[model samples]
Target: MAVQEHLIESQDRAAMIDPFVQLAFLNDAIDDLTAANLDLLDAEWFARYARSVDELTARLDAISIEARHRGHDRHCGFFSTKAWIKHHVQLTGSDAHGRIQTMRMFDLLPTWAAAARSGEVGVAQTRLMARVAANPRVHVGLLKCVESLLVDAIVLPYDEFERRIRDFQRSADQTGAETQARLNHAARDAMMRQKADGSWILWATFGSLQGAQVNEVLAHFIQAEWETDWAEARNRCGDDATLSDLQRSEPQRRADAAAAVFLAAASAPGDRRAPLPTLNIVIDDTTAEVIVSGGRLDAARYNKMICHTQNGDPIDCSEAAAIALWGHIRRVVRDASGVVIDMGRRSRLFTGAARQAVLLLSDRCLWPGCDRPNRNCEADHSLGWKAHGNTVPWNGGTMCRAHNRLKETGNFSARRQANGSWTIHDNDGEPIG
Candidate 1:
């Protein structure tokens, strides 16, 4: 309650010098709580504690919105308030954005904000309501219905409440719901990135039509694999294996089938973006070892050669060997001084293989926090080619069309650092993270 009072006071003092100083007080309060005997608390005590914390969070959300309104975030040297919250509060980017968005919706719907403050509607449920309220096409009458339910009910399961809200949306405006579904479909994407420990993670989202097609293909492969597994199980167990015992877990089977689908698709000829699959590696000649992107190849890693991707995710030699099966290798020769002597280059603007190389190297748009894939980006000279910049590996990076225009308008400047990172400056000469 004292912390909630402090948060309310902070709003009136929005011009307070060094907003980060208030953050330090909040951190100290959190540390004090962490040092308390939370685990020893009983169930009822824990429930009450959680409720109080949720109320505190709601109040802080209001204060955060007020702070943003007064431009305190910018004065604190942050590019955006969301970025500031991510760094100072230690919340993930998505979580910070969600909090901001929820508060904005609360400002629009006062009744829901009051309910959240009173702990009638929970923090999670409030956020969900905020999301539903964000749909511009949803009639105000639907929100009024939700608000009345919140004010009258003691407690409603969040899932059921969400369903009721959706029912309202569908009944009130089926056309809008269909149009929103189409918009969501247009945002489908996939990402493959390696982790720090040499393993890879794949994340993907698909539209309804595309997802149905993929599911159909995966089902065919799954059935085939399932039958093979079943036969093997029966052979090994003779009389013991049951129908359930014959099959692998659904997730494992699906993973295997997906890999099969991809490998088969790769081998099959079709229209493609890049002519060949390629893996880029930096290696040191002296120790016959792989070199990391930034650090020189001379650095020792447990007295053995080490390798990693441009993003600094480690990989072993065997993995590189596996990739070579699908892709041809290109060599970069260096002189005795460890300077690259030849990289197979020609034109002023990177095209074909060269453009592909830049895309693969950058992985995404060079603009900070702009996750637009390199496939959607245009190759740009980090140093203007008109100013004598060469079309070489070290001089070229990928920029999405929007960011490229910002560069052309002199609002942003970018340069490749020796460590392979891009140094970007805003119009005011401030560095953006």
Candidate 2:
């Protein structure tokens, strides 16, 4: 029966062979095939080998330094360090580094390393074993136990492999959340690869909230000017109060108040864009404050705040006149019609010279973990716009289109309080509360 089994597994003599692959496998398997015994290399003996390896590595490094002594001119680019190793060392990039690290790991752990080296399993599996064996800190910390539990992972059935990993993590007190976070951080890669050619469009689905947060932060940093995006706003809020601090500084604080009054005076809450009007508010040395109502205010309830001018004098008026004036202020408060607004279109509009006011209200993106500019985001109705959301920037916010979709579709939601701030939530109908 044994003879029959051997004959059944024997290769066909007529089959073609690749000398390169055969040599590669032999070389790859040698370390694993070697047993760990004092006779082979005790501490003293291995010390000599270590010295030799170090000297050889130093010589190789010197060669690299000499080659780059001068600024690179591409004259000998093909003869660079990698090319030299591939040609003379006869090793691929992946193989070379892996071999070096694996050998180091093996030498550092004799018994466990030798078992892995001696074909207890294949290269990938053995490599994992070597990793667990060599790291004393991790070994002591229980991560090493994963190796014994997941031995021969390369050959293990998928179900078995999964079971072992879970078993190992659970028994070892390792949490999936922690493992996933590490993987994401280590492997995270994002780039606007084609944007170097100058195109203003990008599209990709974010697989996690972490990814979306990263994108938000990056968007603000990439802009040519300080954009009122959620990311920038968050950055501003940290350690420094950002725009709030800047606008409220001793030199600029009064203007902040004036801007608020101007915003409040100009905001027409109901039928938002009733009539577009421009008014500049100024109060020198005295404290000034304004509030721009983004949505329709129940005027009968909150009429006292807006009807007052910069001097704090109330404008006594007919309900009809107040209603008309309210609409005009709304349009002028946010000139963009809640669409494409280039504050740069009239630099003065954003500049202190024009002394124009932005809708001074909630300042940041409502998205959790998102500190972005309100300006860059879409003016989304916390409630659906079609469902009675007025087209006023006061009722609006600057949110990226991405968050806008999430808000609109109920994947995310926000509710602005009567006090003009907001609370946000994620897709599961769970408030980020």
Candidate 3:
């Protein structure tokens, strides 16, 4: 009976190899599978296909490991299993390396290997487990325990699975996690390249902690910009027209917000590469220092000494006092009409206190979905000077160059509304879409 079972197993294995008996047969099989009626496949079919592929990948990895252990790579004139896999399978160096790492994980924990072969876990989830198991900081026994927990975690969503693994690792060894984090932080790098087409692309890798902080700042600006759509709705007195106002997608908002953060940081006084705006603290001569509206100190209580920038960002009173003591100060006085009565400087273009006043009122680029801080924007006339527009605060609005160009080319228009907010219009005279 045992001899008959061995013969059946051998025949089964031979039949599996029969279809891929040659390179042509394998290539034709792949082509045939690709040409199958994939559009008719349901979600269940997709899930099963994905799981089957993962299982096949595990079997391939096991075969590769066995071949390497048996010195087949040397016979094939390859220096390493990675090189062999890359040459034969057309995988990238990183993919080949990851395959070897997976094989190592399988060798260290047979249960994980079994689970991977059974399609109980996916390739990505298996990779995550492999990384955790291979952490030199984790003891062998602890990894065994982790490997077991991951068997249950295999059913979790990908993100949740990663989080659970991280939590487990952190709980098992806090010091090791910190050390790994430091290593990861040390590996961080950023590169910005301007393409020949005058477009810039940024590539960056950040440690988890810094990445979280960056995400928070981006989210804050994204949310702020998103909220402005509703603010416009309120300005329009809850008109149904605003249901589709300012059609920037969420991804675009996040991208613009990321750029705004970098611009904000570069505008700091300590950064001397460019002439950026300083924190303007408008104050009265009252020695008691009762706070008035405007500058960084707007809406502060008379008893308390909170200060603000012209753009209405709060600053520490000490920082405000230091700026007051030494920074360039140009007094800007506004009349009851809310027009700048005194700009303390004169130019064809709005500059100095006049520019600051416009920036303060505008708060951000007049362009919809642009959350660029006022300081980074240029002051522009909503109506062109050639069209009889003045350089006064009332005539001027804040805008980044891209939007200003649109207005210049007659593709965009901004009209001051009754409530002090500007109503942006497209070239067709429709509200900004």
Candidate 4:
């Protein structure tokens, strides 16, 4: 009798507490947090605080989903849920649509939704997952492997996680991937328009393979300009040279490179046509075998297959195999550590095939968060030539010119690990990433 009476009393108290009151309490807590001194907080505290915020955001999203289902927007005299959100939250139309789409994704992915509500997953990761889930061809497969994908989302870096999702999409729906590739090729377009100021603006889009080819030629010309800038900066500023000392800004160099390309094309001999740029497509044995056999492999094997351009853009397996037939294919051998063990002969400096091998080993500059393409980077000696570092691919890593100069200053250091990844450190001996 006493237990029943206590339960009734608890139910009455719960019924008395309004949602607006709960929100008011939440606002008060946020005010306290905003007033707290951040200087006294540590990294762990900040991480925990971010997770708490994520949890709250997830809860709000859940409430929004319920409101949409209940036709709350109609009751509030709004045409749609998105319009209601846009008017109330001061968000743009696109942003409001994105919120609605995310709500739908959460509805489809209950496991992920629960994890989000618990603060175990982040907004960025959830957004990426939602994007993959939106793909009609791979949606079912994504749902089947949500548990494993969730683990990857938690553990891998954002860039790698994105790549992983792409791999999954390609492997799970090869036909869809190839069809999309063809559509992209069909949609290629370019236009140049002169502005009122007498300057011109060029806008263009190309399929992945064609874009890579165009970028390769541009990068070669840009590299020549980079060399000139380095020479001029050395002559003028000597040891204290910095990126600001360069003769041309990056955009200016790109424009110059474009002009050079046009002039070179106009001067071509005999046929009056420039030769096609060579593209380097890398494919692992597994992917090549699948292409040769004309049969799909299990998802696990397909996910592990490596097929991409040197610029790190994933290519459809069938498309890469077709390109391999006409292009010169060079074999690259790597050791168990994923280090390029053999490409060609070594020399005093990274040149010829050795230099090419270094570029092939990396898609971008070794510096964390630096997205400069490999062709625009210098092959740096990790241990320094004076320190007896060999001129082999194993001893070399790619770095942009500015970062190379920074490393030479001794204020920063970088080491290439056995896995062919770089570990960068600051002057204080703290790892940069």
Candidate 5:
């Protein structure tokens, strides 16, 4: 380890340009492809080159692993082994960790690895294939068959490949995993798809549903709300203060929480909806009207854009901005596009730089015991956001929904001191600094 570290330090000390540029160049070189030639090419060529690299790299990795496992001792057998790679490359703790993991996936599954290397499959399709097929050999077969149809499979985006892989798995018809290999390998796309605006058409469900099954249900729920008059839903709430108030107040305050995720198998447009995850911030129909008319309460100003004039007008602001300023919740937000690149914090006094730093510090969520990725992770103010807890990165940490809820519901408390490191406490009062 020490020798490897020294070798990396010497390499870093040597003059070099940008890491990003270097990575891009190296990625191009591996495929026997060059950017110089790409200047005159079409999109298809890019796909082909990517496919080539995927195939070449996968083959190299498999060979490298076979060599190492055959050559090395019991511990640290593969070059792509994350800890080994990170130690050898001297990567930042996070980049080193992530690359190591991704590479290991290629190493662990030979068939998918070969398919990836052959540029015969898209990453998303490959990932789904890996999950559904579950065996190295099967994945390899999938790659061979799937790649045969496309000019450059590597260039194909993940989303585009999802349905195709499913079709192949089902033999182009609706069926369960065709074989044990398919069952062992297939993984559902866990991410909810997004549009340029924060509003997502997500597939929502609870209780172990997968793919379009959940989304079809959500399409029904959203349709139900949009199609029916609000009178029934609201009246039910009004008749009982608790239930009525619950729907009106909580739902209004918590519209972002209500923004359901779509995980449907069929990407084709459909009509269905799912019951919303409730936050219990009920608003009376009159209150909804008042808030939309510019009631100065934080919820009014915040969700005015999320909520409406009781007449269902679109609240012209980004749902993120509306939720951030008024909802008293720090939302995990995607740029007007639907991926959570940054916590929607520009309006809350935190800059993008700070958000980046927090993400880096935590890598994912910092709930101590959780491993949610950055997309589900939020930038949490060590102190409460409204309690004059500055939105500066120094006062924040990347935390996922579960822990963020911990902070919000007061199950945990965070203290940021003069030096800016945070100390968090649990229900039993043990402190984690």
Candidate 6:
């Protein structure tokens, strides 16, 4: 019986080796799957379908790589593999180029390719890995840690996984990262053009750090516009007001807010010193020493460093060092676990310096699925004041007015974790993702 089963398996494998057989099997499978009633499918079925699709995509990518290796494009009268793919696959130019690039990256990183083929990682995660692998300065070093990064890709959210990869690149090639930052800064430009219609077009480019600053200021102005719209809607329609009742569309509001920003800047008083925007830049001790002394650090030491904006956007350590020389810097110390060890004030309400510290630390509201910016959020006690929570930075969390009110009603709660992050729980004490 074992010999018969082995013979059958070998026969099946050999049959699949023929391209026509594979195509017939795929066509039949897709037709059967698509014939199913979509309303009858369960969550588990959808998940399994997605995984199968990803595995098939990986296999197709592998075939594309093999075709490129065999010079099939040249044989087909095409100059480049990308051009042939664009034509044959009916994909956009950019999509075809991206697909070709990703396939090439898979040839270089076998572990990632294996994981992709097995459906252990999805296409989005693999695309991010391909992007990192394309960087020459970090490509060789990144290959050494493919397994570890694969774990992150499988377990973490896409955004966090992207951050981890970027952090690795920065640590592996700090000089290259710094040079790129300098190039971006040098290339920054802004232009205003008047069209035939009486309206004007504004365009600008900024490096990561400077763009973050611009984004921060724009967020405040946008929030102000939102507040006005919300107030007007509530006043007109009371609690029945919906998003459609808003006075302006989102794009219109953003354009108005941009104009408001320019008007505010132009009208500012020249005699008095305007308050500069506060940007939180986190750096560890060793990296700070290296940046301050203009010295080089080993990759291991660089890996230990933490240098990024408050919103987790990594910037060049050298740029942070230069800013520290002329900017008013506030030192907030944290312990090994990233819990703030210093800077606490005694008060019932989160006020003044304490409030500023809370805003500086928080990028958005603590409530799950809430992306209300910290500037528009109110600082609240995770352990309520009535419950004897201390009025310290560690005890406080940021939440929007609506969510804060909901928490106050005792249907929800928040906890400040050891790493200075917040976890919100439902009325049943289940943690919300």
Q: Which scores greater on TM-score, model 2 or model 6?
A: 6
lDDT of 4 by residue, 335-365 (tens): 2344554542345678776778778777788
Candidate 4 matches the true fold with a TM-score of 0.79
Who wins the TM-score comparison?
6
lDDT of 3 by residue, 1-433 (tens): 9999999999998888743356577568779887888778787787788667666676555554444443437776888878887787778998887877777778877787787666566767878777777765555444446555555457555644564455455534545544666776789999999999999898888765445345446656776776666677567765454445655766776778788788878777784653333334533243114222222221112222213344434333333444455544332323334565344224568876677677766556877667666655788877767677777888788998667877878767888776566778877898863
Worst 10 residues of 3 by lDDT: 297-306
Cα shift from native, residue 299, model 4 (Å): 3.8
C-alpha lDDT (0 to 100) for residue 99 of candidate 1? 69
**Candidate 5 residue-pair clash tally:** 47
lDDT of 1 at 318: 31
lDDT of 1 by residue, 391-410 (tens): 76667888987799888897
Q: Which residue runs of candidate 6 sit more than 4 Å off their true CA positions?
A: 1-23, 28-69, 73-77, 271-274, 296-305, 328-335, 341-348, 360-362, 366-372, 401-410, 416-423
Give the clashing residue pairs of candidate 1, or none.
Answer: none
**If scored against the real structure, what TM-score would every candidate get?**
0.37, 0.23, 0.46, 0.79, 0.27, 0.82
lDDT of each: 0.60, 0.41, 0.61, 0.75, 0.45, 0.75
The weakest ten consecutive residues by lDDT in model 6 span 328-337
lDDT of 5 by residue, 354-403 (tens): 65545544334655445555534667777666776666655677777667
Residues 99-133, model 6: lDDT tens digits: 77787788888888887777678778887777777
Q: After superposition, how far is residue 219 of candidate 3 from its true place, in Å?
A: 1.2
TM-score, candidate number 3: 0.46
Between candidates 2 and 3, the one scoring higher on TM-score is 3
Count clashes in each candidate, considering only residues at least 3 apart in sequence or on different chains: 0, 25, 6, 0, 47, 0
RMSD of each: 25.8, 26.6, 18.7, 4.8, 23.4, 4.4
Better of 2 and 5 by lDDT: 5
Model 1 CA lDDT for position 49: 89
Q: Rank the candidates by TM-score, best first.
A: 6, 4, 3, 1, 5, 2
Q: Between prediction 1 and prediction 3, which has the larger lDDT?
A: 3
